[model samples]
Target: MSPQVALRKAFSAFPTGVVAVCALVDERPVGMAVNSFTSISLDPPLVAVSVARTSSTWPTLATRGRLGMSVLGSEHEVLCRRLSARAVDRFEDAQWHATDDGAVLIDDAALWLECEVRSTFDGGDHEIVLMEVHEAETFPDVTPLVFHQSQFRELHADR
Candidate 1:
């Protein structure tokens, strides 16, 4: 197999939590589905998401002062696919709420975070967007969405 395909297959072995990174741009809510979300630090409360260099949505989000990140629930499969689809309104059939500061969070997410783009760094084909969390909330009952091998999954409780 080709090197790229090999690498992609290997990467898919790792399971990741799905998150919707969103913000209000020009009074319109915009967002993208990301599986590269991670917590960076705890002292100051930091988080990060890796976005591809060719992402048109990233440019608009970069210009925004604040953003919202929603850790999607297991039931958000359709929402995840829609957010990643090209030439479609990401929020068209999705339900969400926007904070007064313009941060948009998907409804029923496992967790919600209000953040600001703190810094960015070049990653080979993607840019690592580091954000500082201003506020956060967790839904104790919601199960987080998981992505693995290009498919969505759910975590089953261990017996």
Candidate 2:
């Protein structure tokens, strides 16, 4: 197998929580699916996500004053796939809410965070974005969506 395919297969062994990074751009809701979300610092309320360098959406989102990060629920698999697809309206039929600061959050997500871009760094093929959270909300009853082995999964506790 090619090195790229091998690396992707290896990475797929680890499960990751999916997130929807979105914002209101030109009065429209724009978003993308991401699985690289990470909480960086508690004291500073910082979080990060890696965006591909070739993403046409990131350029627009980066210019927004604020952005929303929604931890997708188990029911959001279809939405996640839609957001990740090319040449289609990501929010065509998606339900979402926009904050006063223009952060667009997916409805019924497990958690929502309103944030402002703090910094960015160069990654090999992606840009690592650091954002500072301005506000946050949680839906404890919602089950988070997980991505592993190129499939969307629901978290089940073994009690």
Candidate 3:
């Protein structure tokens, strides 16, 4: 196998939580599904997500004053796929709300964060974005959606 394919397969062995990064652009909801979200620091309330350089949505979202990051719930598998698809109305039937600052948040996500872009760096095929959280909310009972081996999975607690 090619190095790129081998790398992708290797990376898929590690599970990751999916997140919806969204915002209101020109009065419409715009979003993208990302599995590369990570918490960076607490002192400055910072977080980061790696977005592909070829993504058309990122350019538009990057221009927004504020963006909403929604930690997807186990029930959001279909929604996540839709958001990742090309040339489709991602929010066609998704339930969401926009904050006063134009951050569009998914209705039943496990957690929600309103953030502003702090900095960005080059990461080969992707761009690493650092964002400063301005607001946050969590739903303790929600089960987060997990992505692994190219499929969506649910987390389980061991007794």
Q: Top TM-score: which candidate number?
A: 3
Candidate 1 C-alpha lDDT tens digits along 13-64: 9999999999988789999999999999998999999999999888888888
Estimate TM-scores for all models: 0.97, 0.97, 0.98
What clash pairs does model 2 have?
none
Clashing pairs in 3: none
Better of 1 and 2 by lDDT: 2
Q: Give candidate 2 misplaced runs (Cα > 4 Å).
A: none
Q: Give each prediction's root-mean-square deviation over alpha carbons.
A: 0.8, 0.8, 0.6
Q: Which of the two candidates, 2 or 3, achieves a greater lDDT against the reference? A: 3
lDDT per residue for candidate 2 within 88-125, as digits (tens), equals 87887789989989999999999999999999999999
Q: Pick the candidate with the highest lDDT.
A: 3
User: How many residue pairs clash per model?
Assistant: 0, 0, 0
